[model samples]
Target: MTQLTPSPAGTEGARDAGDPLAEGRSRAGWWHARWVVPSALAVGYALSVLFRLSLVTDQDHPTVSPDEQMYLVMARFLAGRPTTEIPGDQIIPSGYSLLISPALRLTQEPVHAYHLIMGINALVSCLMLPLAYWALRRLNVSRPVSYAVGVAAATLPTVLFYTQYAMADTPLPVLVLLWLIGVHGLFSEGSGRRRVWFGLLAGLAAGYCLLTHDRGGVIIALTAVVLLAALAFNWAPRVASALALASLGVMFVVKKLMTAWLMARIDGARPSEVGNAVFDTLANTQLMRRTVMRCVGHLWYFMTSTWGLGALALVVCVYVVFSKRFGLADRVVAFLMVALLAGITLAAAAGLPADGRIDTITYARYLSPLAPVYILVAMAALYRVRGWKKIAALGTAASAVTLVLLAVLLRLAGAELVKSYFVVWGLPDATFLSSLWPANGDWGGFHAGRTTVIALLVLAVVLLLRLLAGNRRAALATGVAGLSLAVFAGVASAAITERITEPRTKGTQGIAAGFIEAAGIRPGDRMVMDDGLVWEIRATMTFMVLDGRVWSRALNKNAPVPAEADVAVFALADQQAPATDSWRNAPAGWHVDRDVREHQFVVWRRR
Candidate 1:
């Protein structure tokens, strides 16, 4: 049903059809070589992701608490249970929780239910693999390159580790990638009717993107700008853009309809949650100004996280934008990625409340959905390289390495001994980026963990230069860069899992989960969380003793406790706790069942 897209996309893609890697396409048996190869590759990638996530996702407890706790609470609420969080704090979207809700029904134990959600995470997140492979194909990226990038993208710790958490990020990469594909088809397809279909498809993905994560708003905004570009340039059919946008409008209508029914069942949730702080970002010039340093910090750290492929990717994107040699479609996609990188980085940089820690430098988690671009960027740079463009890419990459080395030097010079601050903000454990400190100092004589990255980046640039030399040079350079990145990513991700991600649930938090249960809390108990307890304690209490009927007293200490709640879970450090600053202990008229002073926790029952 598909016809050749307009040239030079068609012209360039036709050249790729003769690629030795795609030789099988000539033999179109019943299996249909075009679909068969990509399908097999997709299935293989999906299974690998599922298997990889399975090994580490079955944790005793959540590592990224509060965020995980919030998700769990949201899931239970979606699964026809009572609200678990304080009112006004539930600005979080329920899109990911909708997926997690089904798993809660499979087991009574909170941990088991969490594990089932992890399995669900693996399943839903792996959909990105197939979608990614298909997206690359739609973009007319060569078959071998598409499949290779698809598999390579899965190897990133960002792609794997987040699945262990119940955060919306688990499914974002796929959703974002799929939306981009729809945008491409909506604009570049030969048939006007097919274009409208693609537009509708894109819009649906865009709607889901909004639901899945707050960053989805940024994605939607980026799409709006891109669609406008399509209109101005006459790149897309007017009907297609209208249809794509209309689908997202329908999504809003659906959300509004669902909100009223949901509000009745789950308390404390906002009428509808869409974008958070997005308006403040645009209106406040100071907020935008403050984001500059943070934005650069986020980008620098992300480059480090990607092992320096981000630099090459940036160069490739810039080159694509200016180079008319690339077809309209290729350039537009390139522009989209580049824009997304900037938009996400800037948005992430904003609203990092003035904190003393240098957390931004280690924060790479924000733009991780763009992980696939690392290898793909270098590969694009390799594709159809000219003398001037190759020079420019190499020069830019070299400059990036210099900047990286300089940043490390500056860090060493102005370093603080805030070892405690290295604990990550979201996933505070060793599983996250902040925990990867340059130990023994950045100037540890001949050895520093940071130097290893710099060296690799320098080598990658050198290899790219070599790659541009000739066919013989290209073979050696390509093989070394490709194989090295692949092996490094695999080993690094595995080591991270073994040394870090695995330990999070088994550490203090896991012990705490058990402690909470042993301290007189039981599975499926209706619990009330005292407002005076700290966030960490609250997260653990909510997580360990879930019955879907958990309610927060919120900020009102005088607020009446839920009449049906069986237990009041309080922390020793709470304001109302005994021996607190006010010398207060226990809520009035409550009976203390267990005063576990050693653990700084207590369980109480209503009189």
Candidate 2:
């Protein structure tokens, strides 16, 4: 929200002031740069919101991925359940569900509650827009470049995809952004009181980030690393460094102590198997190599998905590091990025499955908090690129890289490399770019894939032009167009994926809900479900009636039915329909009361 004074017309540098083309371009740049790009960004925000709405049905409500149900179940507990009863099987922190609780408390309908949670996520995630702009401005990036960065932060496919879910990923970028800005302020601000306040605020933001997700601990650790780096290099005042460290230490210790206490209070209620699994997973270090490999792969896909912004950020950070005039804040930002890299690597290590699932899908969400910073660095790099010759050099290099990448992708179209990249990173698990540039089909996916790349390339080309003509007009126009296209790509991708996948997700939820309804599952009914059922169904049932008498038994072939239960639910492996036959292995005296076809689950009433 910082106000920037629009530079006067023709004040921008000119290569040939007497040349008609140069003069005209300068005037055009001045004219468009002031209003057009920002206006387009505002429009992108609106479109992003609408696209989110399109994805907000029961099918895509939380997400088809079972993790969303866990958040919902946790939120249900926060809304109206005893601490002892909350499921601790999932090791995720409670901050996200706690955020969703207010909305749930206001609405009994699950769908309405989901809508509110999505809206909250969208708003929180959108905070990146202002934060990006402000961060770029702080770095002395021009208005035009900064606006593009803000727009990109608002419209990137990764940001949009996560916003549609009720996960902790959405709010993380905002918290990270705040922590970055706060750290930046500690040295930038001159007044002692203001610096103290900034340090406290930064620490608080770091603490909250840690509480929201385990990756948040990375922020706090990164801040401490920055302080050490600063002291080692004599970058900032000793007093300021001390204050920042003190504030962070207090918050970190306080949060850990409080979380430990709360865990103890709820410990007796959690299943012993859950505790055993968590501790066992934490102690294992045998898979360290696999964890590192997945982390590296995750970073690669993250760069690819974000339109090469990650590469751009790396280029800028390298430039800053090698620059003779780089200062304390520059080192802070650079080290912060390093800390993130280390933290993320550590997170992936901690999250490695003892069962060897070892996929990086969840790690991408952890990496999302770095997106705004990536945008800021890229924008700043673009802003610093001056002159026609320099622009051409950079553009040529960029174009060459893009061409080689595209060619490699085409050549490897049916190869395992492309497929494995998506799998390792836990992407949709479909063929890479299959939805967009389908190897087996048409160009209809252009809006989902190529348009975004084309737009960014266009923006890159215009950045080169700005170096020669210093025309803000062309830069602003192409930048806005590029960003608009990116937004379109994101919305189109969301729509396409939703269309193809929502039916299955919705079908599962509907079948589960329908079966429960048909079986007349009242609040106090003793309901037995297979302990081996997907977490989604179990969590969904718990969320349906927080205080219900739900019990889990290993209801597989020959497993005994709970004598105290009035009803039970079971699911079969793939291709088998949910029916009485699906439960043929069930103990005698159980009659199928309802069958959920989509999910292959059945409810049985004791006869």
Candidate 3:
């Protein structure tokens, strides 16, 4: 048996001589190549999916976030009556609910359906890894460097966490990354036809973003500005113009469709209230300054809290800038980062209210898409350091640290802050990690687990350093080993602790489903649930309007309950309106039913 030696630089030069872009492009095709980064992303995301599924063990019944419940309720309402009041319009776009309706139909389980859709969203977002690598390579970065960045992005905790949840951030980032890749491709390899195709993709992305959430519109606007600036600088005027046109056309079409749908639904109902006073107040400098400050304060908390990894990377990038090792790409990245940061600041200044709660939630999830960019910039800075082994070692170390910290923070703090942050921002907390640490728990176990994970991570980093200084191939192998071990240990620890402390809520969905089935709902059977349980109930029975009472009460102050609901599902432990003898006393033929445990669901036949 003859042993084959590694290819020399001379042979590599010959390969490149055959085709200039060949070497760069070949990296994309390499087994552990830049393209393979998406595979790692897929693995991470798969873990996220499993973790989320574990949280909602019963597929027939699922535990959904407030926003998700809102979507489910709205979608079910639209599917049946087509004339029901659209719930949570301000926080979430109607398009999302509409999109989710089809998924709900397939699963026949609201929570399961929600997670399934979110998993798809997460998978789509992970696809950005390969697309981003393609863009980086097109920008003339080495294939290995590009691949490394791609892998880093795939394994990013922020991205992985959000990917498996039913929220706008999952799809929004995927769209943005796709847009970036298209923009890069248009400038680098696109002909007139390619420009047109790229433009269409860009437009579709912008439209999707706009329809998904209000803040998403900001992404479109920023994209337009960036494209125009690039054109002005002669980067690719024709391509930019095409993209601009495509984006505008798509936005117009999406807006028209949404408006038509809204108008059709609200034809007989009261018109949506327009508040010019609030709008005018937002234009005022004093109010704007206060709002901006409040938003910034919230943003600061979000950065330091669960998203500390992205924050740490950003801090590192800033440190790199001060060290005076900036390149042309770095400058461009810096400018784009500043532009995005400034845009967020300006948006907060323009829109957020002085009240801290509203501002924080509104802007918290908005920072997610920016997280990838922050990581990318940090990776770019890391790549600027000479020696491939150093790059690999540092990248591995940074990734390990980030993963460990995120896991620790999540386990210790619980997901209240994370969930609250997104809800405040009009986004859903759909990520797998978010569900791991529920609000009620000691959180000490999580803290302890994090400490252990971090220790292991630090050891892995030290081992990585040793591998780097000695043998090149061994360093690469060791880096991979360290990452694998850290991820495995972190996830396993979380799984075991979660299971031990809070075993899977047994057949929780069955009880909820049982209530719906027992109700014998009719076409015009109006139902109201205290905590939006009616949304889940709708999956089992037909109801004219299954209003989410809790969300309604929270969002609409002075909104009264309909006097003639066919059924009322109330939680026994509801603090808002506790179950009492008076509550049980209804009209003479009204029947009240209790579940297996401490739960009360009523069925009232109108007399």
Best by TM-score: 1
Q: After superposition, how far is residue 156 of candidate 2 from its true place, in Å?
A: 0.9
Off by over 4 Å in 2: 1-51, 57-61, 82-88, 143-145, 228-240, 261-292, 354-363, 392-425, 428-504, 510-512, 523-526, 532-535, 547-549, 555-566, 571-607
Looking at model 2, residue 327 earns an lDDT score of: 58
Worst 10 residues of 2 by lDDT: 1-10
Give the per-residue lDDT of model 3 (tens digit) for 27-127: 44454354454575466556645654454333333333444444555565445433343343432455565655666556544445555665555446656
Better candidate number, 1 or 2, judged by TM-score: 1
Q: Tens digits of per-residue lDDT for model 1 on 361-452?
A: 33556688776654455544553343545545564674565366446534642343133144433322113332334453221121223433
Question: Which parts of model 3 are misplaced by more than 4 Å?
Answer: 1-65, 77-83, 89-91, 107-112, 132-136, 139-152, 187-192, 230-233, 266-334, 345-364, 387-524, 528-565, 568-602
What's the best-to-worst order under lDDT?
Answer: 1, 2, 3
Worst 10 residues of 3 by lDDT: 1-10
Best by lDDT: 1
lDDT of 2: 0.58
TM-score of each: 0.82, 0.74, 0.63
- Candidate 1, clashing residue pairs? 577-585, 578-585
* Each prediction's RMSD to truth: 5.3, 7.0, 9.1
